[model samples]
Target: MLIKVCLNGGRLRRDHPAVPLTPAELAADAAACVAVGAGAVHMHPRDADGNETLAPTEIAAAVAAVRAACPGTPVGVSTGVWISDGDPDARWHTVSTWGSLPAADRPDFASVNVGEPGFTALAELLLELGVAVEPGVWSTDDAEHLAESGVAARCLRILVEIIGVPADLAPSLAERILTRLDDLGVEGERLLHGEEAATWPMVEMAARLGLATRIGLEDTVSGPGGVNVPNNSALVRLAARMGA
Candidate 1:
């Protein structure tokens, strides 16, 4: 199973002291995670004010830095709806512009949330640019929706993101999602993860399911047994050990 590390999301330093916000911080943290057994890297690029942005320059810098640090490892970015204030056209414009970037500055793939506004068009645009897409599903409905959209086969993989739940409930949530996907004939690699309290449990469940999983400060701030994890690399190490 592939163990990817999400370096950071839209989280601020207050969320986690070690969350990598800038390019240099991301590159160094990415290198550490890779060394500890991360198979890929996923991150959200931030602008000068430390806010998440889909600006080409920010994306280019973050991708370039992580590539330099981790070499051949796959690096992805989030195309979440928050980036465009729920405007599908704005999201399309931002991602379309990213396609124009020089190859060295582009992400290997990007995660597109299935329930978000303009998801289908954004996935189509990414495919048109030759960049891979990871369809992100947050619920069973999302899984059903992605299956019906006819773009499942075009993606690099499916990302089952568990959210807004207690840690103990994540496993059932994941099982329901996978079952729904199975029922709909959605076949391909699936990566599962969760946020905050649900993070480590979901990763552990994904491991037991023999599917790919991910971890990082973006996913959780705690380690195994709910210990406070110090950095992204530590989270990767925890997930790697769990997988083993």
Candidate 2:
């Protein structure tokens, strides 16, 4: 179990204006997150346009900065279909672009959302490239499909996301994930995260289950105390408190 933080999600600039987009700002946030005990860090590489891109240069630059800032921390990037100008084979292009990146600046891992067209291909590509894979399961069928698809057997870790849902239902989502893991008869690294207010409960449940967790503006625009968090480290530190 490893606690990670997602630095930026989407449109967070105005919601929590302190969210970092520049490489220097991202570097500072990574350093602070690692200092506070988060073992892994996640982020989307956004250019000056504030749109996520999977281009080799964008991924390379951001990865280099974060690695330099937090030498030993595992760096993972988002490979979501939501990325702007995402290709019909976007997963292939985006992930292969990451795979071909320089070793020193290459991402340690990258997330592949389940229940999508390019899901299995991205998983295989990541495995073949030797980049750790973190598969995010947002629904019961996603977990079931992964189990049957045989990707789960090779996944480096699992990140169960219950986005846009209520907090009270999160524990149930956690329960189902555990059950799905059992049903599949496969167990590996796992973490819980969600969108907005329910994000807190998901983290709490992660702590209670002694499993890994993630927090950041990507998941919630508001701070833990409902004040806007200046940076991702603020959310990481708060998640640490739950486990502390």
Candidate 3:
């Protein structure tokens, strides 16, 4: 089972002082997380002023730095709608241009929420660029749509995002989505995770089931036993211990 650490999402430094926002910070944090048993990392590239950006230069810088810091570890990025003003066409264009980067600067994979508009186009671009796609399904509607889109079979894996739901309810919801994917013959790694309050609960559940899981400040600021964690590495280490 793999444990991916989401080094940073669209969060600012103020969201968590240790959230890595620059290439250097990301490299350092990624290295530490890997050393503590993380098999992969997911991060957001930032601009000169630390705002999240999909610009090739920024993406290259972040990807290169992290790879240098943690050799052989896969690093992925988010391709959320916020990156393109909620315009699917614009998002597609941005992702299309990512293929122009030199080999070493490209991410190993990228997460594309199938629920978003034009996800099929974006996923196609990533495949054309040799970047693996992680189909993200945040709701039952998204899962049903993904099964119908025929994209799940081509994706590197599936991201089961359990958001806004209480911990007690997340498992059943996650299982329903998983069952739907199963019925559709979507077979591969299925990463089950939840946001905020449900994060650790789902992580523990994933571990018990021997399924892959993830943890980082992006998913939750809390650590084992509900204590606030100090950084991405700490969160990863605590999750590793839990899974072990």
Whole-model lDDT per candidate: 0.90, 0.81, 0.89
Model 2: number of backbone collisions: 0
Residue-wise C-alpha lDDT for candidate 3, range 97-211, written one tens digit per residue = 8878997889999999988999888888899898999999888788888878867788998999898998889999888988888877778889988988889888988899888
Q: List all candidate RMSDs to the true structure.
A: 1.0, 1.7, 1.0
State the lDDT at 41 in candidate 2: 85
Error of 1 at 35 (Å): 0.3
- Model 1, CA-based lDDT: 0.90
Write candidate 1's Cα lDDT for 115-222 as tens digits: 997888899999988789999999988988898888998889899999888988888988899889999999999998888889888888888888899888877788
lDDT of 3 at 87: 86
The local lDDT score (0 to 100) that residue 83 gets in candidate 2 is 81
TM-score of 3: 0.97
What are the clash counts of all predictions, listed in order? 0, 0, 0
Ten-residue region with minimum lDDT total, candidate 2: 82-91
Instruction: Using lDDT, give the best candidate's number.
Output: 1
State, as a TM-score between 0 and 1, how close model 2 is to the true structure.
0.93
The ten-residue window of minimal lDDT in model 3 covers 221-230
